[model samples]
Target: MLQRSFYERPVIQVARELIGCYLVREIDGETLVGKIVETEAYAGPLDRAAHSYSNRPTERTKAMFQEAGHAYIYEMHTHALLNVVTGRVGQPHGVLIRAVEPIAGLEVMKQNRATVKRQIDWTNGPGKLTKAFHITKALYAHPLNERPLYIEEGEKGVKIARSPRVGIANSGRAADYPWRFFERGNPYVSTFRK
Candidate 1:
């Protein structure tokens, strides 16, 4: 598990470095693991696309204001999107976990995502990855180093690629910011790869 200091860095740095980290989920005694392949930085307060923009701390985004290394799950339509709260306590920065490559508990992940005709589709999107890992609102504000969900160190020499974040065309000039990062040629990366 990574220390709190690891997540207390700048949002963009955390997002980029998270590219090759391992996201682990333990549910019902089964351990599900995946290599994080895609991430997007949300520079809170000033980022129009971030839920914590304007320093607003509503019930849904209150976790964003918590200390770094906490889970900040939010709903998109009916699906839950998982984010890692980064930066200091009063800073609402975060890193959205967009996609992951399944590494362990493949059978359980397939069972969770029943329509997964191909392995890549199991975690190719934020919502899909959350579903496959059983992440939900219940995990909001949970510490990333604690039980059910946590992150572990992964390979050290991975090459990361950067691009504009996905689905935020209305964020003005922030929409063009190259805050999205992913493993260079990983097939399990999201379909929006650039």
Candidate 2:
């Protein structure tokens, strides 16, 4: 298991490498584990799609400037989604964890989900994974290589594919950067767009 270091590498590399890792979240005496299968990269300052582009920092985006491998969690509507801020200090870039394949604590995930019709449906989306894992603002900027909430290395023998980011209709050329990575034909992938 390759435990991630907060300063191990650049955001792009981290984004590329994260495709096969596992995201584990422990909460309320239960552990929810998932195999990471999808990610999207956001580069620093110059990347228009990045939150820290142009170095314009805000309270919400402040955590993104933290060292690499730190979780940058935030709320989207009523859902909290988890992201990993990449790049070194003073550089605000990140990779959004788009989806994961549930591995452990699935019963907890079934309970967290709105409608767990099947095992795969338990953690098929970013927001759904957050609910299953109990990820929230409390985990914002938390280091990814540390205890309680750390990334665990999983089956590391799959090929990854880079594609244009989903749901960023207005990012212009940045939307076409092919930074989104995912495992081909993974059932846990979030395929819906809205």
Candidate 3:
């Protein structure tokens, strides 16, 4: 598989490229893989919904500046979510990997997920994906070029649909931007309808 070009484009572009990529994680000598199916692009300092809006460079958001193709993991209300830092070094922008469809090590995912049905629960949310994959703060700023954290081309990428992202009612017009992309009818997608 071709390694993604970290400097190819902005967060929106990167977000589109990210669809159908495989997010690989290694836990306890076992490898878990999931196909990227959903994503949301948060672009520029003017993007009010972005973590680094207005170029606010706090500790939690500093990862947004460490070039693209790096993991930006953060906690939200005691839940860990993952984002891919994108754009150039000085540009504070990223694409939040909202959800994924587990493809490998599903038994591990089931064990991590407990009894939440075989579908609709494996990796449909940011926090859920982390829980299912055993991802945490330890993976923060982890280089995607290394093992246990790299993304690869999935088995025949799917066509992505663009729509406004879920939640973010405080971002004004930015919240309405159709930057979210997802596979059609994929059970692992964040939501079925736009």
Candidate 4:
């Protein structure tokens, strides 16, 4: 599992570095592992796309304010999305795991995402990945280095790629910021390069 120090850096840095790392989760005594492929950065209050922009305190964002390496989970469109808390406490920096490539426990992952017909579709997006791993709000604020859910180190030498974030058109220039990171040529990356 990755140590807390790995997530203590800036949110953008953590998001970029997460590429090729393994995201591990345990459900019903079965282990599920996926290689982190895509990520989007939401840096503190200054970044308008971030939930903590303007320092507007709210319960939904509470997990995002935790110290580095915590899980910040929320539900959207009835699908649970997972974000990794980064930076120091009160910073509210987060790295959204947009997509992952299945690494192990294929049977369990397929069962968890029973509705997905294609294997690649099972975890090609944030919501899809959470479902494939059975992740939910129950893991909110949980440490990323602990059991049930954690990140493992991956092999090096993978090429990293970045692009403007997706689905945030209303955030002005924030939408144009190249805050999304992914492994170059990785098929599991969400919203493939144009």
Candidate 5:
């Protein structure tokens, strides 16, 4: 599993390097794993697109300000979005896990995302990947270097693609920042492009 040092780096660097890592979750005696395909970096305070922009803190944004290697989960439109907190404590930096490619326990993922139009849709977006992986607010603020949920080492030589982050079009120049990273030509990446 990835250790604390893996996440205690600049949020932008952490986000870019996450493209080919493994996200692992174990629940109810079942294990599900996916290869991280896409991510969007939200640098703290200075990043207007960040939840903790300007150092603003709230009940929901608390996780983002915690030390690195924690899950910064939240709800939006009734769907859970998962983020990996990065940098040191009080930084509020994080990387939103935008997509993943199913690596194991696909049956469980299919059950979780049964209505998805295709197998590729099972984890082709932030909310979709959370549902497919059974991720929820219950994991919010939880450490990510341990059991139940953790990141594992994965392929190291993946070619990366970059683009503006999805949504938050009103965040001024922040909306145009090329902060999104993904595996080049990965079929599991989100269909939306900036």
Candidate 6:
């Protein structure tokens, strides 16, 4: 399990460093694991693309104001996206886990995403990844170091690439910020790879 301090740093740093980390989900004795392949950083109120932009705190975004390392799950359209809260209290910074490569419990993931015909498609995007791992809004504000969901250290020395975040075309100048980070040449990265 990663220590709380691991997520206490700046959101951008945490987002970039999360590449290659293992996202583990232990449910009903089945331990599902995946290697984080892509992430996007959302800085505090200053970042227009962030849900907490302008210091706005709605009931849905309440988890973002919690201590670092907490889950900040939120709904987008019909899907739930997972974010790791970062920065200090009242500073609503987070790192969105964009994609992951299956590392364990492949059969379970396949079962969870049975509609996905291709193996790579199972966790190639944020919503799809969360579905495969059974992550939901119920996990909001849950600590990342706890059971059912946690991040563990994975392979080191991974080369990373950065680019503007995906699906934020209306964020004005913030839309072009290079906050997205992904493992170089990782096929499991989202389709928006740059």
Every candidate's CA RMSD: 1.1, 1.9, 1.8, 1.3, 0.9, 1.1
**What 10-residue stretch in candidate 4 is worst by lDDT?**
185-194
TM-score of each: 0.97, 0.91, 0.93, 0.97, 0.97, 0.98
Give the count of colliding residue pairs in each prediction. 0, 0, 0, 0, 0, 0
Error of 6 at 7 (Å): 0.5
Comparison by lDDT, 2 against 6, better one: 6
Model 4: per-residue Cα lDDT over 8-28, one tens digit each:
998889999999899999878
In model 2, pairs of residues that clash are none
Pull out the clashing pairs in model 3.
Answer: none
Candidate 4 whole-model C-alpha lDDT, 0 to 1 = 0.91
Q: Score candidate 6 by TM-score against the native.
A: 0.98
**Would you list the clashing residue pairs of candidate 5?**
none
Model 5 worst lDDT run, 10 consecutive residues: 185-194
Model 1 agreement with the true structure over 9-54: per-residue lDDT tens digits: 9999999999889999999999999999999999999898888988
For residue 160, model 5's alpha carbon misses the true position, in angstroms, by 0.5
Report the backbone clash tally of model 2.
0
**Which lDDT value does model 3 have at 111?**
92
Q: Score candidate 5 by TM-score against the native.
A: 0.97
Tell me the lDDT of candidate 3. Answer: 0.83
Q: Provide the overall lDDT of each model, using Cα atoms, as 2-decimal numbers.
A: 0.93, 0.80, 0.83, 0.91, 0.92, 0.94
Candidate 4, residue 111: the lDDT equals 90
Stretches of candidate 1 off by over 4 Å are none
Model 2 lDDT, full chain set: 0.80
lDDT leaderboard ranking: 6, 1, 5, 4, 3, 2
Expressed as tens digits, the lDDT of each residue in 16-108 for candidate 5 is 999899999998889999999999999989998998997977998998888899999999997999999999888899999999999999999
lDDT of 3 at 146: 80
Model 3, residue 182: distance off in Å is 0.4
Residue pairs with backbone overlap in model 4: none
Q: Write the per-residue lDDT of candidate 3 for residues 112-182, one digit (tens) a residue.
A: 88967765687998889989988899889887768777787675658888899888777889878999988
